[model samples]
Target chain A: MFSELLGIAIIFGATVLLAIPLGLYLATVYRGDKSWSDFLAPLERLLFRAGGIDARRGMSWQQHLMALLTINLVWFLFAMLILCTQGVLPLNPDANPSMSPDLAFNTAISFLVNCNLQHYSGESGLSYLSQVVVIMFLQFVSAATGMAACVVVFNALKEGTNEKLGNFYDYFVKSLTRVLLPIALLVALVLVFQGTPMTFAGKQPLITLQGDTTAVSRGPVAAMVAIKELGTNGGGFFGANSAHPLENPTYLTNMVENFALVLIPIAMVFALGFYLKRRRLSYMVFGVMTAGFLLLLAPTVYYEMQGNPAIAQMGTDMQLGAMEGKEIRLGAAASAYWGITNTIISCGSVNSMHDSHMPISGMSEMLGMMTNAFYGGVGVGFLNFFVFVIIAVFISGLMVGRTPELLGKKIEAREMKIAIIVALLHPLMILGGTAMAAHLYVSNPTEYAGWLANPGYHGFSEMLYEYTSAAANNGSGFEGLGDNTPFWNISTGVVLLLSRFLPVIGPVAIAGLLARKKYTPESAGTLRVDTATFGLMVFFVIWIIAALAFFPALALGPLAEHFSLY
Target chain B: MKNNFASAFRLTLALLVLCCGVYPALVWGAALLAPGQGQGVQVSHKGRLVGFENVGQKFDWPEYFNSRPSAVGYAADGSGGSNKGPSNPEYLAEVNTHVAAFRQQNPSVKPGQVPVEMVTASGSGLDPHLSPAGAYAQVERVARLRGLPAERVRALVDARVQQPIFVLLGPSKVNVLQLNLALDSLSGR
Candidate 1:
């Protein structure tokens, strides 16, 4: 028990340690006034001109909104072109084929929009060119888009009737050069040290036992694995995910991978408060988010350690702990920890299968998906955090009997309305999507799983999990759902599109409104977002949104399955 | 201006060197240092090496412990599963066939108590080891087929146990290929 707690703490601490300087750097970079290291300034300008993007085009809230949509659309097409045409590209000794159109558009838009919907495996499907251009390229762009949204909001907080949000060209460069690139390179090196494979060689051909020849999958996996975690994008190079011996070979490597997953999302909290010249506010947000994140973590360790009552009922030796879908080396600590981390930040990389996870353990993971997943999309976590901040601002204003003023802007009907939509966006997508998937697909309840195979509720939970995973962009499946079919493909794709954009527009509009208001002087009655009291409210509000949104539905899915097993 | 230009040139040159020279070479250095890591876990047949297996695979065949269920065909590039609901007739059929095959080959084992891994494929479908139970279940058959004592076969299983490379990485596991080759050495198969 102690060891598991220590393991969870190590992962959380390592992530927060990174948040400090990186957060400070992000804040200053987005502010765009300071000269970035004497050497990096001109190079930044050069990149803007090369992309055909205007360096001088500072945006209004309206323009910023359009730019996000336009940029995502353009990137979707770019990613699609690369995926469909990857067949003829280099690094194909066996001439690996191209993706079909439906998958191509789905994947391309998914990555560009930061959903990272990985329908194909990275080690085999992608050639060197597609890996670099389509997949890796989108990682950087998707990460930058999140940073770009935060900068717009940062400027909105500082706005005094100014049309300019911040510099988009500059945000792109700063995110790419300063934050995302350096961190990705660092984590990749660490993973290499911890034993993730990094090779450009073809699959090492070897004869199988029966004398049939087969080729092993190999590629530039280490580089992509690094960005996948740093950007909070958790697609695996191979289908075994981090469980593959090559992808995650050691205990240290497992720890490193888990750290890489949450590092950025946690750091963005500090980045928020620090960049806004409100360090306390970032800590406060971190504190609230951490409280909710930890609640999920606690039960995860407890239920898995309590051992599966089913294993006891069957009277089989389970000294190996929750042996279903978990590795002996990773043990319950990894299953519990990865579940907590994925839910906490929304990175969805799994060391063990979650569908086979104990019921309460699975519920905590689902709650994490519903509540924060902020480590939402890469820069998306911070964008989501800011939405919570606006809500905090409105509620505090009402408590003090004053107009809710955040970063000098009045929280009027427009901003509050947008915040409400952003807050509700997840519920509508997650709960509604789960209900629809449950009702439509999943008809054959009996003989669902040969082991967990029984008639009724357990199977229904599996159906609910499939849709929740899709709508939340969580990506980890129940392994029990037949999701590769066109029915799942189209529905999941549509849910992914709406969940991603609708929630995003709310923050964009709020940031725009905030940008127009001037900063006001703080008085005794004025609310300070950085205080401990306000922090508690933000935590409760986040919980309220999650509970109101998900608990009843959760009762239908993982929660019920958890009880039935016992 | 000239001095400023010289320093800027040097800085860019260093950045270029860092991106091109240091990064790629460092990664290469790390790869070579840990040749036994990740997909690098190869099964050697004397002087010749055969293949790699993830620690997650099952090994039930007396000649070899099978890898875990990897529904994704062994194409490392095409990582995925049958995505079949466990309730689906197809999945059940596959599981039952695995059970039938195991029962036919190893007659000594009690029915309905076959280790779970023997019956199901791993999610990746390319695992390379079996559970100790899985390896032990096959011990009797491999020994009888080779005309060796069952204790000796079990001893080989005990010997090949590679207490996980790191305890925190996964469950304590033994490599399937290593155990099989060692079994061959013992029985001179």
Candidate 2:
């Protein structure tokens, strides 16, 4: 218990310690104020020249959005094409078959959006060529995509009524080369050292002393895992994800991967502080996020360590903590910590199966993903949080009897409308999809009978967790959901597209709209967002919004599950 | 717009090389510098390789320390958990059966005293290590079967228990395969 507590503390401490400096560096990289990466400047310029991208040609927020959308469209098409044709492709030594059209669509969008909600098992579902070309490719770009979007927000925020935000092409390329690549490289080396396989070999057959022949699947796992964690793209090389020995391997690798999950998201938060030159405001945002994180973490760790009473009733002593669906090496406390952190950061790789967690622990995980803004995914996490920040600012503006202005720009009906729609859309997709699934589940039980692997309240939780994970752009599942069907694939594909883009559009649109407005100076009447009062307000706004939208769903799922267990 | 499209195309191809090709090659190169060369630490018995130390193998015999129960029957290929909720009836039944089997195997140990790790399937079906408590619980069975003193076996289990990384990263665990090999050496098998 002490070790688990200490491990969580160290992980959280290490993330902040590493992120602060990395955040500053990222800020400098985004601002382009200095040329520390001058060595790569020639290569960057060459690529720009090759593509006819004038480095100085700035984009309007609309143009930036267009570029972001267009590139994503291209990726979706490319990924879909490859996924549908990977059967005949080289490097498929295992001869893995092509994906069905619906699965391809789901997978393509899943990777393109950086959600990576895989419906198919990694070892069997994809060939090596597809894994390298599609999965690994999307992991890098999807992460870069998020960071690129945030760079747009940074540019818009930096300029006071300036018409030109930075070029999307420039930001996209630079984020990949300058920021994500180096860190992933270092992390990849560490994983490889700790025994994650990087070979291109297929599954090796092993004959145990017990005379059982098992075929072990091996691939370029180390490469994928490094970026998968670092980029906040949590697609597993295997179905069990980080729980697999080859994927995580050792305690050292587990720490490395967990640290990697929150690395960029936390760094991006600090980057916001440095970029805006308002360190205190950044700290305020960080504080609220930390509070939300701890709110989820405390219960998850406590209940997961408490062991399932129902199991104890069955005459099995659970004094060693909840061992079901958890590794003894990681133990219960660290596993609980991983669940919270993974959901909070939108890194869905699990060292422990969340499906077997205590009912309340599952609830905490689902709630964390639903909020989706407590130091969320790569660059998009803050963008998601910023939507609430707009709503909070507008509401506080009304409360304090002042005009709603953020960073000297007025928050009028247009900005408020977009923010509200995007913020509201998450619950709409989550609840609406869940309703459809639940209706289908009851009305046509046989057709979708196997859709949910568990029955009753836990079954409902599985369905709820699926949509929640998708809408939040988090890709972890209860694992018990037999979700590799057309219904799930297409349904979640649509949800993934909307949930991912709308938030990006809403946040960047607000930032862009604000950037074009004339700068207004701060006055005594201005509500200070950096103050503790406003931070608390933001915290309450997030909690209130989550509680209102999800409280009923919670009542049916983990909440009910928890009560029934007792 | 066309220029922007062209830029996007060119950049994608460029990054494909850098990220996909060059990056993986570089990582693979660095892995060679590390011990075991990313094939994992293989535990061998009498020169023939037994198994990877990091991966779990089935050890159901009373004379040996039992590894964690696997959901996939210790298949290293498709490693996973018994993705069952705590309240699921099937999971409870399975646990009950596992408890019965454990009681049958270690008759001297009380039902309540049997550690949960012995009955539950791990997240990775291939959980190579067991908690120190899990290992210690089986010490008596292993000691009696091998005609060794329980105190000596306890010392061996204690010695094989690995402290968490830097004493704060993970839990204390004993690699079941390594412990069993030590037993073989002690028994002069």
Candidate 3:
């Protein structure tokens, strides 16, 4: 037990320690200041020159959105074309069939938006050509897209008002060359050394020690797995995801992959501090996020370590804790830690099955996605948190009988509308989509009997979890959901598109509007957002809006299951 | 709009080559230095191909320490868990069935002495290792079937027990396949 607790502490502590230096480096890269990574500059220049992009030009927030959306549309179309015809494409040693149109639509949008909510499994559903050219390609650019959008907000948050944020293309290109690619290379090589496959060979048939014939699936896994964690794109090369032996290999690789999962999201918080030169504000934000993270993490670890009460009733020794749907190498503690970390950051890769977790632990995983802002997905996590900060600032300002201003810009009614919509949109999409699915399921249980793996309360969790994972752009699921049908493919596809973009647009718009307003420097009367009191306000605002909104639904699912179990 | 589209189109093409083409090729080249050259580490027996070192295979005979229950029956081409919710009556019944079968196989072990991992399905359906308790629970059955002394078999299981990195990082487990192979040599099977 001591070792298990120490294991989680060491992984998280290592991540934060690594993130500080990475955060400073990210600030340097985004600011275009000269640093050691300048060696990659010539490569960036070549990319810009070949594409005919003007890397020096500045962009308004509107222009940034346009560039981001247009390029993303290009990717969506490219992904669709390959996915629908992958059977005929080259590099398909496994000869996996092409996706049906609806699956393709879900997959294309899922990867393009960085959600990676795969309706289809790897190894058999996609050819190698699509895996690299479409899936991995989208993972790289989608993450860079989020980072670029975040840099736009960072540029806007400076003390003086300005229309021209940094050029979107410049930030976007540098995000790939400077930040993501180098780290991906280093991590990929480490994974390869630890026995994660990077070959393009077909599955190798083998005889087991028991003399049964079986074939092990082999692929170029290390390259994709590295970026899948680094980019917070949790799509897996194999159906079992990181839980698969070849995909994860051992405990050492488990620690490495878990480190890659949250490294950038935490680093971005510190990057905000470095970029704005507001270290105290960064500390306050980090404190709140860490507090929420520990709250979710602690209960999950406790319940998972306490073992399943149902199994205990059967007179079995559960000293290993809830070992069902968990790797023995990772054990219970690290698996629970990975589950919460992945959900909190929208990484969504699993080292253990969340569906098999204790009811309270399942609730914690759902809460992580429902809140969607504790060290969020790559660059977008900060954007979601920024929305809450705005709402908190407005409420605090009203209470103090003064107009709300954040970083010297007044927050008017216009900004509040956007923030509230973005906040409300999360629950609206999740609950709304879940309600629609439940209505269909309850209305015709026999017809859609295959849609759920467990009946009653646990069944309802399957549907709710799918939509919650979709709406938060978190891709992990209760794998028992049986969610490959057209209904799931199309519905979650729509949710993924809306949930990913609108929140991004909402925050960028608010920041842009505030950037244009006249500057009001900090005064003694100014609400101190950097203080501990204000941090508590933001924390409450998040729980009230993000957590409380889903309380009734959670009651119907994991909470009800918990009551029945004990 | 036209200029933006053209720039976006060209940039997408360029990035595809750099990311999908160059990045993977570089990793594939460097992986040549790794064991098995990034083609998955394989284990062999008597100079014949057996299995990948880290993937679990089914071992149900009484002479071997049985692997954990698997949802996909240890299919390596694809993998997943049983994904059974803890409170589901049907899932609980299934666990009860596994518990009964385990007791039938090993009559010497008491009802509550069975390790939970022996009956529960693993996440990947390809979990390579078993908790030390899980392996030790089956020591009596395997030793009786192979006609070896229980002490020798217990020592073999002990030798195969892998501690967590530095004994303080993760779970201590014994790889099931390796342990069984060691059993085969011990009994000169």
lDDT of 1 by residue, B69-187 (tens): 56654555454444433233444566566667777777877764566555544444555556677677777788787788889889888987666433333445566667766766786
- On the 0 to 100 scale, the lDDT of residue A467 in model 2 is 96
Error of 2 at B129 (Å): 0.8
- State the C-alpha lDDT per candidate: 0.65, 0.87, 0.92
Candidate 2 chain B weakest lDDT stretch, 10 residues: B34-43
Candidate 2 interface RMSD (Å): 1.6
TM-score of chain A of each: 0.91, 0.98, 0.99
Q: Residue-wise lDDT of candidate 3 within A283-396, one digit each (tens)?
A: 999999999999999999999999998887786888889988998989999999999999999889998998999999999999999999999999999999999999999999
**lDDT tens readout by residue for model 2, A255-352:** 88999989899999999989989998899999999999999999999888889887777666665689898888788888898999989888888989
- Compose the digit string of candidate 2's lDDT tens values, residues B39-136: 66666788767778778888887788988888888877777898899888888888888888877777777767778898898898999898887888
Model 3 chain A: ten consecutive residues of lowest lDDT: A309-318
Better structure of 1 and 2 per TM-score = 2
**DockQ values, each candidate:** 0.19, 0.69, 0.85
Candidate 3: segments with Cα more than 4 A from true spot: none
What clash pairs does model 3 have? none
User: Model 1 chain B, poorest ten-residue lDDT window?
Assistant: B3-12
lDDT of 1 at A145: 74
Q: Which sections of candidate 1 miss by over 4 Å?
A: A1-5, A31-43, A52-58, A94-96, A121-128, A158-162, A193-195, A209-213, A442-455, B1-41, B53-58, B63-123, B127-171
Ranking by TM-score: 3, 2, 1
